[model samples]
Target chain A: MSVTSLDPVRSELLAELQQKVERIQSGPTAEPVATHPALSGLLQLRAGGVYGVDAASAALLLAAGPSLAGAWCGIVGVQDLGVEAAQTYGLQLERTIVVPEPRERWLEVVAALADVVDLVLVRPPGPVRQGEAARLAARLRKRGAVLVAWGEWPRCDARLTVAGTRWEGLEQGHGRLKARRVRLEVRRGAAPPRERELWLPAADLAVRPVEAEQVRRVEAVPDPVRVVS
Target chain B: MSVSPPLRTMTVWCPDWPVMAALEELRPDAPVAVLENNVVLACSPAARVDGVRRGMRRRDAQARCPELVLAPSRPDADARAFDAVLEAVEELSPGVAPLRPGLCALRVPTRFYGGEAEAAAVIAERIVSLGVWDVRLGVADGLFAAEQAARRAAPQDVVVVPTGGSGDFLADLPVEVLDDPELVSLLRRLGLSSLGAFARLPQSDVHTRFGTHGALLHRLASGGDPHPISRRQPPPELVAALALEPPLSLVEPIAFSLRTTAERFVADLAGHGLVCTAVRIEADVDGVVSSSRRWAHPRWFGTADLVDRVRWQLTAQPAHGPVEAVRLVPEVVEPLGDHADALFGPGADEQVERGVARVQSLVGHDGVVAPSVQGGRGPASRRALVTWGERADGVRPAARPWPGQVPAPAPATVYREPFPALVVGAEDQVVGVDGRGGISCPPARFRAQQGDPWQRVAAWAGPWPVDEQWWDEAAARRVARFQVVGVDGSAWLMVVENGQWWTEARYD
Candidate 1:
């Protein structure tokens, strides 16, 4: 078929394929994750599970850098990100430029950064109203910048849905080493919810997925194969 | 039936004039005394208690306080320092005039400045706020009357001499207010105990006895002559001092302080539409002070010149210790005319000045110099060294010429010290001649411990010879100077004949 003659069918199929690819890419598939050690330890805890939604949002922002290059990324409805996650990512501590206090002069600070900064990672001062968020997003878009609105983004183009999970067989002990298991649930781009089990070792963030077949093999092996070769 | 009016003018006097002496003795900070002849130079309220009045002799003042810290007056220093005070006051009024060294007269039109009392109070408050809390302010219709009123006013008080009431005010004032001791004694002999009694004397009779002096006193006593309040112009010259805390080390802070002081000093000159030809910076290290090697530049001074002089003074400061304070005083001021061309042409910028200043600051002031030509027979004899950025102004006779000196069209560049030269051959002969038939000298073949290489001679000129200053053996050198054009097309003045070839100058 000539390139121009295949337009209609091609367009339809390409749109469908794009949707499928995005769904699959955004889904809960086993993927290697890089995280600093301190954050990995906190995530291993059972009580008061770490907010997976905020973490996933931050990760998305980091990945979408070229699109959101010089934008005001307002993170709202999330005090946990402001206090811990942002610092863990080295965003708050590594800044060499002027760090203005975030209070009455937050808008002024934004104005001052209009010419200088690339990405402004801000946690909003108050609740995120839909109208205010929309206005801010419009302004950011007009400025050719992206807005990675975290927490309660009112009218976002992309969203990462998170479900809580707990680790099993992990206990706080006096020994230097500890091991634990975790379950993750993620849904994105209209994909069905998926679950995965992973092992988190002390002092490391290498998440090794525990396969069902491997579990069966362990059960079948029986006491090191009856102590035979 | 008519009613008599109350007294409109009242004088407030300090009963304890010697309190200033007491304050000086009791408190370490008190070096205060009343300045009477010149309006209250300074006074400690303590001096008032012992009646050690302003203008009193040192002996009389001591008798009163017994332990008075009697500081001999420094009117000039006080006036220079008071420029800062006057500048601060200039913000209030444009017509401020110095009535005396320590006293300034500010004229405020009563209509615009509320009333006389309000104006006086405002001025008094401003004076007190200047950390001079013991000022006695007086307001009157004219300068003389106001001054008299101010003198009679108590410390920290404001006395107002009402208009049209000068005659009544003087009625009770002692005849001693006449200012002349002879006139006072004469008036006392005439049984005139008060100015009111003195004014009753006929002017003709007063003039006959005291001549012009008596006539003047009679007119003043009667308030017939209007006190001429001529505006006292600002000083023709300016001097400023900066007191640094914790002393200073790095040149940057000292330069910063100097920048501020120089700005003020220049601004003061600019106020009079004048400029300074010479600026003297005196740096006080500990208690000892060292003045700068006086530098004369153009009328208008740049920040670099000021900084350079300050740096020079500071660096040259004896090892007495770090400087505790610095005083930049402009000693000579000349009328600024329309001369735009810089002393060093426009090509010179602040950076060059700053660099020169930095060098002078690091090394001694005499270490950095500009080339000056002197009258002499030899190449070195005609050269004199002068501090950078200063004009030589006049030609100085050359001390003496070196024997066998090279003639005129002297080398364009002369090194202060001769660098060791390489000899091509043992005797006056050329060796190792290249294909071009050029002789390679030392530095070309022979190298110094540290320096650039010398090139071979090309088209060399004759060795012009002259011997001079043989009388002073310590300051004499016999050199056979020759001008040689190098293979690289660079002309140099080389000396030979003593079996040693020294590269003296270069003309590239």
Candidate 2:
């Protein structure tokens, strides 16, 4: 063995230690799952990580990627998730299982679905406790599956929030809604929030990044503050 | 070996029996027509008298008979209804061959009923006693001549051709009795206008000119029996029933006790080279059915699946009192060979199904669902959720262009039930939609509930009219929709129907 190298007579011992450290860091990892084309540059979804989203649409968007890539997905505790929107967002409907209103046993349902499906999207009945999330996280790492939570969670690898939304095709009273643009804020561990402008849906029913100067840009100035003391 | 002649055959016919079976659902006097593919298959006598004929389009038939009620042709229902008639006829004859739903054939009795005419009359009287009118009977030397005679017999009457007189009996019948219009027209042009004339032609020439089908028809016209009627074997009694001694009320005890019966049920079906895919389980409490449900399997069911269906049914709707008996009736059974596993097995679907079955066991069956889209205008009506592990039946097709449907991008959050909301104008008057698609006032502020804080409207669009099922008064719906953006940059899909406003979905 080289003098500077850590390898010794028992090289297997170093390998064992390496595995333990990797397990502590993230337990285990599965193949990387595809993300929405619009978020490809902004986000890379890895197995064994739970992502939290403020809106139902964002959760649907996260699941759509893996689902469209021939992966099985399960939805728990979301009774009103529009399936048409999910399909339009690129999820394959035939592979999606929805457990609406899982009431008191939602965590168990998520755990069960985690073992079977590649992706599980659950809207917890209430705010999740830290220990429960850690337990679920261990299971996720062991099972090599991803969890997308639509509501409050104490432990998350990242959080996506819809900071602002703008409708483009509607006027005062006559025109029907045709397209939408949203300002998204992505927050990760101890980092400054990253802001991105994207089309939630374009006039042609496509979702992608908004192009520069295609339409007149509005300043989006904040309204005057009103306070009564 | 010599081929044996088919025994002197008798055919019994009940005219318009498909229409008769469908008429069970309507008033007895209502003229009904059963249609398949918009063509009248069979019509009641009342409709017939009004010029509603078979093979006519439904619109034409309805025009001919203004009060004719229409029903889609249900072959299974027709078969089920005719099963009773077959059994009634079977009681008089040991071996009966069913020709179709409305017709059957049997050997003309020589000993049991004494003579051919006596047997025909006895069978006719027996069927009429079952409340099925318009049954006619005919006896001849062969099945073909017998069927033709049955067609010629009047209602509640029987026609008997003298012994070995099948040819003379069918002589006067036209060549159209062959029932192939093309051959009938050719025969008519060839100067053979009746069965007697066609029967007089040389058999070898007819065979050379018209092929085997023509030769078979020539033999039939000559009253020579070549086709033999095969009698139907009665279906086996496969229902398994278990009586709970001392009447157990708890689901666990009932389930535990019924295991042997479930095993036996599966075993019996296997013994007959069949597998049940759909079974109806019934729990009887004090002689009354307390809980009954039909469970279906994507593939054929096994012992465990049968047991699970029994347990789930009992658990879902518990018996009010102790259950005295449990019965399992197979609804849809297929040949075992059709459902056998392939050499390579079913692959990934089997694994996924097992995993889903585990989830279903944990949360009970209906907790998991598969989502699909259906054709409708309203957000709630457009989406359909089917319980996992069950067939999606009777779902309205989604391919039709549903006018007035909410445009995409569809709302991500659709409320299962409309959440009540208040939409008001600048004057605080509640906004409403009139019948003619006019808004009483433009919506200015809205709140989810009465005590919740109101949010100012930023941008708004309006009044996509939806009027559904207008002809059905009780189920009719009239509504208008609006897309309103709140000051917080959130958007909502609000609906107004019957002077009330509700939030139906969120653009979130």
Candidate 3:
């Protein structure tokens, strides 16, 4: 679908993804990650900004590409992030590490991870204090790591909200749930927001950009001439 | 230039180090023997007093000392524990050269402590303070003479050869001191009972009779080093420093603060076209260096790996005081080009390494695992899972030809904990396998537990009998595996043993 026609969530995600791409492109390295061009911008985690993601599925959709393309990604304190679904999204299970819960040491844990992990997907157990968030942001920047927050994060570089979702495989409750289409809204730092629609999990378990189908010509009236008149 | 003997080298020897390390956690006075291939390799003094000796068969040794605490020879364990001794020696000297797990050498620092004898006493005192009561220190012109002097010294003592007197000192020693059975026996047959006799043989005659080994032995007996010391290149100028503000008390904060420094440390190594295989980390609590440790990495330390080591070192214990400064030193480095990228190009999954590392840090190291295939007949036993950054210890060799292993197309999912299930026939009776490896009935339904509804089984295969460790009654298992496909397209490998059914693995 056209970027504007996407539901709010997808538009926001698209705008954020585009802003990352623009920033990476303007820098010395035009192409940040060479393996997965589809995830080039998403993997170039700019320092000092916490980027928010709306759903685990949407997060995996953005993550799987870069993860498979050699970027180290971690899910911290995200209890229900399914390893199986993550594998389906093309992530090599061998390389993925999931920390379901990090209670009191959440900030320290994230900071330690920021040193090594290229991208960290965190679900803050509670609202983080301003100073704590700022400290985390500064660490990420210095370490050149990206923090992908599952919940709202203050002063985020970008935010992607999942607006709508549709599953294609279920046939009246008989068939299994399979392919999923999601609309993502992207809001980047001071950039005009945009949208994108994608298969959150394509038939083959890879995220794919969705293209609008060509509008077919139809006759509203019984006769074309009558309709014209 | 005047021909001069090699500089005097000091040797520190820890007798029966493997036995000592093996019994480190055990009673200090226990009689112990370390075995290799069922033969005694080394034994404690108590075992020796009990008539147990090295080279004795396991049975013979046990007969000699029934209460001997026998242990397998663990070279790696010995080396790992001996790191403490190395560190202790390193505290006294900067250029320590480790000869083996129990022995090390360093140039005698006569100027620092007045003379070689005083230098030996200083080192012995340092090691004794570290709780190694039986340390022996020896100083001589060559490494061999020094090692021999250390071996002959009484426990908790030092032996120093007078300057340029190693040749005179080694003359009367038995030829067996060389420890080469063939040479010793041959020399004895030739009526040469001492090193002096062997050394007196014409150099050309010794070369003609005993070849290179004999010539080398002659040189050693005449007070020459086996090989001239090739001094190492001075350690590279690579140190990353971080000065903490207000000195951090918590390990996590110290680790967090040093993240940038660690990254720069790795980057600096990379800039010099080098990769560090081993690194030394030092934290200054106050003005003086408080804690220092050397860490070896399985792979060259990347930015994250270096940071992980720093965190591990810091968190291993809470510092007595706030950490004021931290420094990273590359202990061992290799040329960057030595590690050729994979021929097919790097795997896109390098990100998963970071993920695994992060999870390990949060969960305290054992939280995340990568599954590996290993040799075994059972579905659960065939899969080996290893925590990240650790070697797959205890894994059965997958290369061996296991006669009755479960045939592949291996299961997609192996339950970490097997689930008990009911395999029933049409009559609602539980399906089972008899002792003769025959099925009691065809499985028609499968239910996980009593309350769960029985799901219709679509297709079935196997009843493959696996009788493992039949001779070991307590460890024996007799099971028949059946691959049953459910109506929902899910397939499971179920086992029937001792009238019990278990869901072992799943195919997704």
Candidate 4:
């Protein structure tokens, strides 16, 4: 009701809001998430390293991180694992494009995927020539979609590499046994990505940190009955 | 009555009675006896010679005959085969009803077959042609009197009961012609062993013992009611198909195929002037099959309606993929008049066909259906939603009356496949063990996917137990079922026994 005078509670609230505004202005701004130019486009992969691509990691990056819902993605692989994982994650996968023997029809499958799908996840056939990889990358870029290559890429705007390491000491069973774990090294854009050591649980698709009791083994002892007689 | 011709009834008796000599056919070198309805209905005269009387046990007949030919009575088979003999006799008389395997009652117009004696001769000739081993023809004013007269006649004789004289003719015959053992016993007890004495009894007492049957007996004894002859037409043929490929994932292809087949089938029926009134579609998956809705359309057969029936069939099919094929068939057809059009207006059938095709494409072949009547003794058996072409015979009477069964009114929707159940605390040992080291109570908790956590049992009923059918040996299951409510507002039908617990069903 008072026009000119600021109450103590209102003044305090204003002071708190101003500090938050200043803090936001001084902090680093997050990068904008990339968007596909078309609702449906294809992602193509060159031979070799593309075939060994990690479909789960690519799916997580596309789905769980930024664009969560209604994001359509396609995975093309010689093996079924990548396509299957993508399906389990609930991505709308059109079809898996398989390159038959003689390998001449590989290009046709890639073209079909490009015409129908928005994002194409590709596992290429073995290794590819630098020219071939670069050509495919260019085609994907023209489609206005990013290609997150897993294994090896001859030419690409950004690259992420993964290295595996053995982990020691982890709990197993009903917390009654010991086991070893695995550590992974992630590299991104010419810089080494963070290296994280994690335990692999007995459950499917579950990864956890190694616990102390897992690596220990129990020993057997001899029976002690006959000495008394 | 004076102008109308008299009705003549005739009966033929086997003469040589080769059925008597055929006893050796059943048993090697053994005398055989024939029995009907578990009475000594007939005996090989050879068996009669061996001291096996008409009322002897099969064992005694065998003992008396030494080597006895035994034949199990097949009343239905005998009656069916006897129809050929009746058909031959009908050439001489329009009215013929076979009263027994070896007996027939015929009503022939006197002018049609010359006269009563000529008609009798013609019937006797036809009976002889049937390879009956012997023949006797008796013509009378009515059926019962004629049958008794024929039985008393010689192997080749013709006996006739005069018009308006059947009552006098039947007076001296034995009381067994009534075919009632109780009546015969009562007559024997009353010292009225002959038809004449039984007919003399007051109608009131006869009716008192047997009600209407006794009255009918009295009338028959007095040669009263005329035997009305009724003929039954043959049952119609049923033609159905089974699809080789189960339309599990694709409905469009199945629907298209079904519509085309149905149209072609209906077109084939055009010559018969018959239009199908009801069509059933059966969708078969693995070993289990589901029927589609039965369609009863007023317009007879329409391609669009047929396609819709198929679409309903496919939609009703279980979502699981094991279906091998779908079969569409019209169950009932009625004659269509010439006024009915051959086909419906253009685009009408097509629109319905397209809609069905679309539904089949979205669902499976079994999803589309029409309502059908299922036959069974119980409430669940009366009606079913069967596929358009499926046989609606799945209505099975419940094994026992389950007044409070889980499916009261039966669920309109049941999952095609039973979902896998997860058991909690199922492996835990019971606190107190029985002498045999088995747990007396089942596990305390159970859970399903994304369902609430285990809750303590609140109010519960059963372990109303069921044991596997031991006689079957193969299908016996030792299961104790209980209904429990969990803490998280879930009701489950659980079964535990023989060291394991399983959630049988859920009320969600």
Candidate 5:
């Protein structure tokens, strides 16, 4: 039968199902979210998998791309988050949901939010059991939502950790804090961790790959000073 | 013969009805004045004793009655209170015409009740039984003359104008009764002090000067008040109620029983070409209101949405006893044609709303919230959270320039409550900054938090002074903040207030 002959509702439903079947055959159950420019070569966030980060800023950075691209986001269990920092990182506050204290309903909240939002960032209060995490993982796959866990989660598809750091533009008592340089290490399934140095957030509050010249300039300062008496 | 005669009408009047409605919020005997646009619309009888009158300026009324309690005028409340009175009268005599809140008219039931006065007595008795004590009735040949007669009737009494006597009855009344202020003032200035004088003017002259409105008033003054009553059709039964005969206590079964009522409620609204966006859900136990709340939606509500809201309300706070009854009342409704999505069908917003509703049900009403950045100097103070689906209002503007705010590249993790930390100078002495921002000694090594091991600070900055709300001793704070980098590259924002240190936030 011709597509024009089908009722509008049936045609729309068929179109949605067709897209899903095509996605399954294409090897990924869900599509990838928008990735930050600095992380273009380093990471691609895929739906149905958990991404782990050691620090809160890394988690915000990971969620920022999809949020800026107009996808709704939810943040759970990270209390008193620096809202100014989140905005600077490109997370649209208007579309963000924050569940500061989920307490006992931690799993239930994330599962419910995953059914709607394209990305959800959660910080669990305690250690997770294998069975519960697997159950949540299955829910994520069914809903095609990405989960970014700030803390621990078993069987994570990838883990991003901030390995090293350096701060510039400060003396014993004179100048103020200006910029930071972080060495990021990415670990994926059964592969050696890849290390990269980048300006996690430069002076302008922009995250990008650090240059060789800027690294030397930061190291130029000779020593940690003692306040001259 | 071309113009039909006016019907015999009975007007029921409630004196100072607006003031009576305002009394619901105040003591019964207190002198109250209802004001609209700074002008007194009505005053209680107690205030009238002190010379408070209608149309008095706010200041003038206050001058007359120093102890006057002012109430904001609400016409909707007045109309709502009057609805019960209209319904009572309608039970005795159908085809009632509502002139306004506090007053109504209907065709007199002369034959069935034996006489006009007896009909008036029956209606007045019915109204008095409904708790309205100050009601009077009047019978006449036309709407205007009947209303005027009702005003003259004593409380709980009936005033009947004899047939063809409306003209003589109205001749002696003052011209001020004409409802229009501008035209009445003009007539008063022309020395037409009584309705008789205004009615004596040539009808053609009144028409040429006052146009249609003046001619109509002239007709009223002449006893041939041409205005006819158009009776109001009773409002449709829109409230849907269900009785749980055995009184089910569980939320699910109660929700199940209420599904039909909810569906009927939506269908009823749709039958009238309306969609309810906000609804008031009430559950009763043993004839007492146990739970009541008004749930609002960002978009129009459907059958399933109403069910979910009812279920959530019950789950959040269960009634003290088993629920015996449930009701759904539409609060805010709009025309169905206003749906912006008619072309594309239901959008993703409805789906998102359903998901959020599930989360709200799990954690209780205030569990899920939408966040936005607001103006403040501290990280915690900058974030405002409104319950999801609620419009964010009264939040501080983020566009203001908040001086002394921590510079850009704000920390990623802000502690909801600042945690105690130790920042020591040389020789492990705790660091302190004097009131003048002079550091006693430089911080050499510090612990980000108590449990974390001490590490040498590779780089450190200020005693940037933050002194706020000094006039309020309880809220006054004098603090010094510093950014310190650990050897491992973790950075922390710490504050030293009154010589005690606390970690405020962390930069990844």
Candidate 6:
């Protein structure tokens, strides 16, 4: 498929803006969307802003807490998302909506989903124009819904990128993939960046702050680090 | 005030309602019979035309009409199908008293529509338009007489007895119409053939012979009302209403405007030391209630919970026009002391409750679900997902002893769809479990697919057999589950049923 295929569908943002422009009053003080209790202070997401996560694993880690807390999460345009892995990371599958393909109506689909879901995770079908991106942000603000982009997004409340990760449970080329420890770097809008180590896919369906001893043991393994890092 | 005369009633009756309800999907004129306890309880008009009648044996009815369709009698189905008819009649008049699945009665407003006959005609027109062609209407001085009058009316017709003619009208009817077959038989044996003959006997003599039951029957025979209709007081309007000038249709904006009203309503109830558990949300458009539904909360409703209910109602119900007003009425409430918050610190439960409520607003109601354990043989069947804030009443109880269910310490995550896998022996040949509850070989390795590298089994448990529904040929199943732990320490629940291997759940 061509990357620049265009469909003649009208932008929902354009249609919504054409009507009487009454500002929708957001409830409360726009508290950040909840993250895992272990990473509560490390990550925050406000409405109308795009948040970035490094890998699909990191995104799933970020999504689990809010989902279990009763927030609905939607995954769009990312076909290879491992839902089984996501469940192990603490996601409530029953409350999750997976639309692996949004096609050309990506913007409209995301906006309509924003009206219903608390968080939307999207890897855009293709490059998004600046104007269309702005309109999408506005809708998110009006709806008090957060957007977590897998790839690059223009304006974001905070951007999180995983620096490195190490997997456990595998020994001497045997055993299955079980859990992983990850070092994540958080960059908030112009604020000084910060870093934290966490168990991204905790085997017990919980993400926790990585212990110093465990980090050291994982770092001591030079052979697997070269292969994974 | 002067002594008021007994109120007259108008009854709408549908014959063989249960049979009709069961045969609703069939052709309207199809010949169908409803059987109860091996006897024909009711039959369609087409079946009746072919000599099938009530009280006949099922075999006799079928023999009389070879094309007769037998439908199992279901009172619940009849009641559900009759709801639409009741709603239609309620639109015309409000005092609808459901006598049974097939019959309902309401007050006769003789003065409003000029006379009893005209009111009955209007009601008949409304019901007929709803596709119930077998509807019959009857108007008389009392409910008992009105019901009898309705039975006398032909299909799609009405019967109206004059104001004081109930006694004369009921006089000639056979005692069989009393509906007590044994009493009718006894009266017939005693030489009382008609209601008029039974009514002529002294009331004291009847009481002496049959007690209150017989006296009540005698009163009905004489056209005296068996049960007097008592006036019912109107319910108090506890709803809080907010009128919108331009009327809002969008859920967010409407929800925004409703926040204050909902909060204030909650506050008012809280002030009275009460908390609402169920609330009725109503939206009006063009001066008529466009939508109204009662939503029940799992626990007491907070301000945010109330607002979420209003939004959920708006989104679920497609309104006819822009909403002109919204109202919230507390349907069920409890004392605040019973649900008082902790004084020292915020309760974890209260926090979770608030978070769930907030999330319910962000997502639709179906967007949030809570996992519950249920009794079943399979991993997926043992788990039940309940929508947040809904009662988990219908799920099977987990306390029942499941004969072959996997032992406790259930997997943390169960795959919604089991993953197909292949379990192979040391030779890499596919292993199998035979019909004699024997493993063909000791499995040593497994893989989800051919290209994927096989994982060696570190430890394994028995392939406990589960043979269910063996008596039901079509639904019978023979499966065995094995808990296999890979060298990596990741355990899986694998099932081998009918020579197919599938991964049911993953344990971490």
DockQ of each: 0.01, 0.32, 0.06, 0.01, 0.33, 0.04
Q: Could you tell me the fnat of model 6?
A: 0.00
Q: List model 3 lDDT by residue over A1-229, tens digit each.
A: 6554789888778767866875664454233332233433433444444678766665665566556766666667764444444655566655555565578777777776666666777889998788998788766766566677888787676787765554444332123334555566777676666666666556666666665582222112121111110
Q: Which stretches of candidate 4 lie over 4 Å from their true place?
A: A1-229, B1-6, B12-30, B35-39, B204-210, B232-508
Interface RMSD of 5: 4.9
* lDDT tens digits by residue: candidate 2, B1-508: 9977547889999998989887777877778998887899999988898999988998899788877888877666577688888899899887898888999998887678898888988899989988898899888888999999999999989888776799898889999888899999999898989999999989999999999999999999999989788877666899999998899988887888888998999999999998897899999998999899888665667878888888888888888999999999998777786546533664445546656776787788788889998888987888999888766654679899999988878888888988789888978899888878998888778875555567877788989988889986768988988888777667789888888888899888
Give the C-alpha miss distance for residue B67 in model 1, angstroms.
Answer: 2.5
lDDT of 3: 0.72
lDDT of 2: 0.83
Query: Per candidate, chain B TM-score?
Result: 0.43, 0.62, 0.64, 0.45, 0.53, 0.59
TM-score of each: 0.32, 0.56, 0.56, 0.34, 0.56, 0.50
How far does residue B500 in candidate 5 sit from its true spot (Å)? 0.8
Candidates 5 and 6 compared: the better one by DockQ is: 5
- Model 5 over residues B1-508: C-alpha lDDT tens digits? 5876546999999998989898877888899998988899999989999999999999999999999998877676688789999989989888998888999999998889999999999999999998888999999998888999999999999899998999999999999998889999999899999999999999999999999989999999999967778987655778889999999999999888888888899999999888887799999998999999998765678889988998999999899999999999887776776654544764455556656876787887678888888877766667688777765655679889988777767788788889999988878899888878888888888888876777788778888888777885667877888988866667888998878899998886
Task: For candidate 2, write residues A126-215 as lDDT tens digits.
Answer: 889889998998888877889998889985777988877787776678676778888777887545788677787778877888776654
TM-score of 6: 0.50
Best-to-worst ranking by DockQ: 5, 2, 3, 6, 4, 1
lDDT of 5: 0.84
Better of 2 and 6 by TM-score: 2
What order do you get sorting by lDDT, best first? 5, 2, 6, 3, 4, 1
lDDT of 3 by residue, B334-416 (tens): 77765545235543344235435544655676555554456788767765655556655567887898877765444434666
i-RMS, each model, one decimal? 37.1, 3.2, 14.3, 20.8, 4.9, 9.7
Q: Report the lDDT of model 1 for residue A166.
A: 25
Q: All candidates' lDDT scores?
A: 0.48, 0.83, 0.72, 0.50, 0.84, 0.74
- Between candidates 4 and 5, the one scoring higher on lDDT is 5
The Cα error of candidate 2 at residue B343, in Å, is 4.1
